[model samples]
Target: MAKGTKSTWSLRRKLILAAIAVVVVLGLALGLGLGLTIGRNGGSDNGNDNGNAPTPTGSPLPSPTGKLPWTPRVNDTWQIILQNNIELSDDATSVTPNVSVFDVDMFDTPKETIDTLHRLGKRVLCYWSGGSYEPGRPDSDQFQKDDMGKELDGWPGEKWLKLSSDGVRTIMKSRVELSAQKGCDAVDVDNVDGYQNDNGINLTEQDSIDFLSYLSNLTVPLNMSLGLKNAGDIIPSVLPIVHFSVNEQCVAEGECQTFHAFIDAGKPVFHIEYPDNAGSKLKEDIVQNFCGDTGDASGSGGFSTVLKKMDLDGWVEYCDQSVETTALNSTDQGS
Candidate 1:
């Protein structure tokens, strides 16, 4: 072979080898880049990855007390009138001592009231506003202007809160801590269904689901049962987490069946029907229609019904023709 031809063939062979080496290096680099990207994305569905993805930093499930296994069932007779500082009557004979539960305002119901009920062997559920901002509450000023959305209709000085706000959740956490501190058995977190009303914050059902999940995580840890208050639409999502359902005027609004999910889940639905003359006079028909017919409202079986005034004063009339009214002094009337 000629020297020039041999040299040219050698040079061509070297260029091909160099090109192959470069391609191999580029392929390895691309694979490494993709592996790093997947690791940063935390591409695991098991929720165990802690790379760039956010780690859930809050409380855990099954609670510290192990998810309240207690189910509040119907025929569970109860009395709850959240007026100001009215005490449960010491005279058990005259006051119907068979009452199973008593729900009262967290702040207004003094520790003595809870102690008195406990002495009477009654379960007490402390009430708190978990979604709305009330001007009279102790933590009212803690709510930021941005956290408030709009004033509630017909309710003066009360505003709907942004369900996703950290500030609002902090205040609610304080309220739950207060309920636990008060030795209450359960918590009736009110105004949780702000999405159902004109909340002005564009809150959705998912927002309420997240909020209730957060709330249940808080209360269940303290061995305190939590009640879903009147947010029937999100029942399927929240029923598994909550222990009871406090429904208002389901018969009037024709939404009683929505609450039956709680009952079907072996949980209690504390049904309250506020008739037109609830405060002034007791309407026999309203009481009969609510608890009487099994199919009157929505073909659901029996429900624990109570006749209450709009303001939720101490006056209560059960299906069995029993009436109990609180006797409050001027100071007890916190207004």
Candidate 2:
């Protein structure tokens, strides 16, 4: 889920909005109509691609403008905190389990934090909410009133974005740009499941596909990896562009199998199961429903699972009941 609210933060964006719009529309048109795109789902190439655009056949665009930082491997162990910014007080490379990656907020986390992780030999996955507009963000003013749809369920101060808008995709691309600038190895975009919610904009699954592919233009050429956060339905068409999957509560929702195709294709599904509210932990038996052998098969053997609190923080409990909290000087943001 979001970090502060449900499963979802800040970055002041200052760019030529008008230029971004033109670039995105033209690039999307060309990729859909003419070019030979490079990436593909490599597995389970199912689903008629949104029908609005054909399966991409050319190189991605708005093409990467610069160099990329890193790419995560399949089944790489990782940790994420989207709702808060941290002030780390210890060596980043010394954490237990020697997890290979860390996913944190874009603006909230200082660039030095990302630098530290790099020094530790760990890759950083920058996280941001691409499907919702949050208040008080750096780019808050960039959103036109109609650009925001219904408020996210239980996630106050956030509203589903009009993903189909040229402006929205432009802003989202800037976020990925921000991630690369901050030295993030990959981008973890959330709330893409907007089509499944009662989002006031009437946003459809096609809107997400178009938006996600456009965002990839900036990542692929730079070599930074991309991840789909919890929009399993579009996987068949989008699998090729993304490097991994960051899912929320699939086992609890009995939808783990929906993402197994990623596994079959040799991609990692960074799975999270949160059965408790913040400041609490799930009972051991209940935890097994997500982590044990009998649980969701997509995550059973190859999945990288983490038992976390609803508000993702440093506190973490693995399936084996092994608990650890990465060293931090501070905690949760806007909770």
Candidate 3:
């Protein structure tokens, strides 16, 4: 062959080889891109790339938002008394009213008290302010000024909280963690309905709903039941996320039906009614009037009513004509 002709043939051969390499690289790149898209869409059930598998096209799996296994449910026939410090009887065999549930202050009720109640086959619900800042609470200082909004009307030193604040959520999460650490079966998150009040920050019902959703997300993973404390307006929205409803003065306010949604949904409403005069003084008429004597207490028959004083001391009067006060020793009473 001529020399120039040989050089041109070699150049043509090199060009052909380069073109082939480019085609192979392009094919591999396309395959990898397709595989990644499939994997990103959640690998197929058969563990193979089958184009027949439908692509997830809508709403992106809800953005992994809110808590899971929501609306932690509590068992029925459980007696709950909201008090500062619940004292066990002298025999210590069982608590009074044959109570099966006790809701006491997180700070005041000791671990031993919860253990005692657990020993008696009772479930303990630790009470704390989730949306309010209480002055006397141990973690009171953790609240930032921006997290606080307005003072709760009747609660002297307590104030509403900014539910969306990161600082507030972190503090509230720590409180829930403390409840679980203290062996509480559930937590009573109080004053969540700041939107209903003049909460100073113009908080809306949606804010409360989002806050509860956040809290439910935190509580459920810990296997802890989360109770909604008197946030009636958002009941329809949060009913599916909260386990129970801890209501105060619903019957007295003639709004028992607002909380009955929990009962309708097969969750308990731990109802509390404060007699105008009873400061830990058990009154039979109050119990009968509230808990229903022949269907008279605000007409909703199945309410679990407990007569407590305004201060929520150890005394509790139940519907079954049983009255017992958890006696607090001087130290327990904070004397």
Better of 1 and 3 by lDDT: 1
lDDT tens digits, residue span 55-141, model 2: 323326422343232445456787776656655544644654368888888879988888877787778888888999999889988
Ranking by TM-score: 1, 2, 3
- lDDT values, one for every candidate: 0.74, 0.73, 0.71
Candidate 1 lDDT over residue span 283-314, tens digit each = 66666777665554773456677778777777
Candidates' TM-scores? 0.76, 0.76, 0.72
Poorly placed runs, candidate 1 (over 4 Å): 1-60, 63-71, 88-97, 279-283, 294-296, 329-335
Model 3 lDDT at residue 247: 83
Q: What is the alpha-carbon lDDT of model 3 when measured against the actual structure?
A: 0.71
What's the best-to-worst order under lDDT? 1, 2, 3
lDDT of 3 by residue, 7-102 (tens): 999999999999999999999999999999766654323222223333212111212322222222333444444444666653488666565677
- Badly placed stretches (over 4 Å) of model 3 are 1-84, 88-91, 279-286, 293-296, 331-335
Name the TM-score of candidate 1: 0.76
lDDT of 3 at 134: 89
- Give per-candidate clash totals: 0, 15, 1
Model 1 gets an lDDT of: 0.74
- Pairs that collide in candidate 1 are none
